[model samples]
Target: NSHRVTYIHNLFQNGAATIAGVSEMFKERKRRGEIPADEEITFIMVTGDGGADIGMGPIVGTANRNDNVILLEYDNEGYMNTGNQLSYATPLGHATSTSHVGPAQVGKQFQHKDTIQIMAGTHIPYLFTGTESQPQDLIKKAAKAQWYAKNYGTVYGKILAACPLNWKNETRDGRNVVDAAVNCNFFPLYEIEQGITTLTYDPEAKGKKVELEDWLKMMGKTKHLLKPENKEIVEAARKEVERRFKRLKAMSEHPDL
Candidate 1:
């Protein structure tokens, strides 16, 4: 389908409000015949990691209202655009400017926020997570997101993007880093449509599963978590990842979920 797409860039915290306003305007225009009835203009709000953190309130409001818009969050784990400060998305024990590692404290203290589950709680029309390392998976999710936004109500999506600078990793290793994250179940590929969950890619089933510590070892920020002193923290994060993936797997198996 040949549809018009309108992209708006704004503060992550304001993305939801912007989309809501623009979507309403377009709907009114179409209703008044100002815009051709046959023409489709999809509204997309592009947000960053901060969106899932500071912008979460508006996002929940938009989702609850079932606004006709697509919210795309490029989550690099921390507030990469703002000097790599720790955001709620940053995993436990991951070093950022705000979350320092020393004898006093070791990286982030608490577990990271699970934005996917948060969005799923709103029961939006569609929600999914994708990463650039898996191009096909990302593309398919994008297409599905567009379709849901057009036919249903709100669609929320997250892409586990790489911030080489913040991650303290070489730019050339971006794909490998994200790939490791997927194989380690830190970022599983999945989609939830109309409250029905589906696992798009299963690393365990494909014999591609790797230990969570292996993924952590690939980046400097999280390497401390692998230390014996910080073993408890890394183990906690690993358990959380496995728990989430297992829950998703169970959901995918049950149709009434």
Candidate 2:
């Protein structure tokens, strides 16, 4: 059947959570044959800024049990459609309309949510995290995801798109900004295959341990997170880098039989 069931969660702070709920609702509907089993089901999530959209990852994970779910995270740092409010994914120091800066103040104090990591934790057979700035990588990953969904009947891919308004840059500067991120080794392009993580590109030619400065400079929002005054935060960020590299090293060395 060509009929497509599209669920949109609007004005709701937790859109992802809403999606999860709807998936359960649909499951029941499908079981009763209210919707034909042979009909193709597609679940698509669209959100702007902030990872506060709860239930999104879980819904994708749940939907994957019987259908394919595609998740897209736009680069909009502020809630554009909803009066430029800050979402959980907003970076540390960006001056969002909701998170305005004043005397003796920092912008958004918290770091952005790592949705990729959250999705990875689900251990989905076919999952990917991509950015539109890297067109070739995005296309390749999308193709792989589609193939996985077709073969295994479940796949999830999270895409990162450009947000010129949030970045305070012109649309034309979007590519340059993404290029800077890649060149600086801030947004390292990589992929995970069947639960195996691989570094796709490394411009810095550094060791397994990546320097924190490379990524920090590109994300103006998180600059304050690494400031000298925030010694603890900086140290914590470094430790995270070390921990990730160590884990990757172990995985690379020990392959599954």
Candidate 3:
């Protein structure tokens, strides 16, 4: 049988209530014989800064309840649609409208939030990271996300997108910028299935891994981090990437994670 899909956009904070209400309404209609019981419907919500920032609490609650929904996050590292203000997803030492770099402030002072890992804590049935740089991998993960959301429970997926305007990179270089991120293991390709972590692509294994600086140097927002005075922040950012990848490696080896 084929499943019917319904797409909707809501404010990030309202996503959980909207999905819970809509999905239950569909099911209730089926129960009343208004729709066939076997007829399936999947609800998908697309959000950016809305979900990762102010809307996070409700998102987490929905995941905790195992709501039947697919939440896809388009992470451009800032609130791109709203003037490129810094969001929780923005990386440390990255300059945004709010996280300005000057003699007083050196970009954002804190690290970016690991929203994917945070969602994993909700014990959702499926969650993965994807980007346009790896279309095939993204497509596969998306299909899997839909399947899990339809037959199992909630699914979350993150796409590390590029904002050429905000990042101050050439529009034509957007794809390559994202590719560099994946290559440097700054944004690794991976998925967590029912708490079992798996690395979809390993840059180091494929000899494609580049230093964190390689990726940082590609974006204007982060180029300042390369300055001698900003070396400490750059090092911290590098260490954070290594720590996360190492933990992910350990988890992939130990299925109990």
Return the top candidate by TM-score.
1
Steric collisions counted per model = 0, 3, 0
- Report the C-alpha lDDT of model 3 over 104-199, residue by residue, as the tens digit: 999998988888899998889999999999999999998899999988899988899888999999999999899999887778899999899999
Q: Quick one: best lDDT, which candidate?
A: 1
Per-candidate local distance difference test: 0.89, 0.58, 0.87
Candidate 3: regions farther than 4 A off: 1-7
Q: After superposition, how far is residue 192 of candidate 3 from its true place, in Å?
A: 0.8
- Of the pair 2 and 3, which is ahead by lDDT? 3
Question: Tens digits of per-residue lDDT for model 1 on 43-112?
Answer: 8888887766888889899998999999889889998877999999888899999999999999998888
* Per-model TM-score on C-alpha atoms: 0.95, 0.67, 0.94
Model 2: pairs clashing at backbone N, Cα or C within 3 Å: 17-54, 50-89, 51-89
Higher-ranked by TM-score: 1 or 3: 1
Rank candidates, TM-score, best first: 1, 3, 2
| Residue pair clashes in candidate 1 | none
Model 2 lDDT at residue 239 = 63
Give me the displacement of residue 23 in model 3, in angstroms.
1.2
Candidate 2 lDDT over residue span 14-69, tens digit each: 55555556655766888999988775554555665454354465445454463444
Report residue 105 deviation for candidate 1 (angstroms): 1.2
- Native-vs-model 2 lDDT? 0.58
Colliding residue pairs in candidate 3? none
lDDT, model 3, position 174:
95
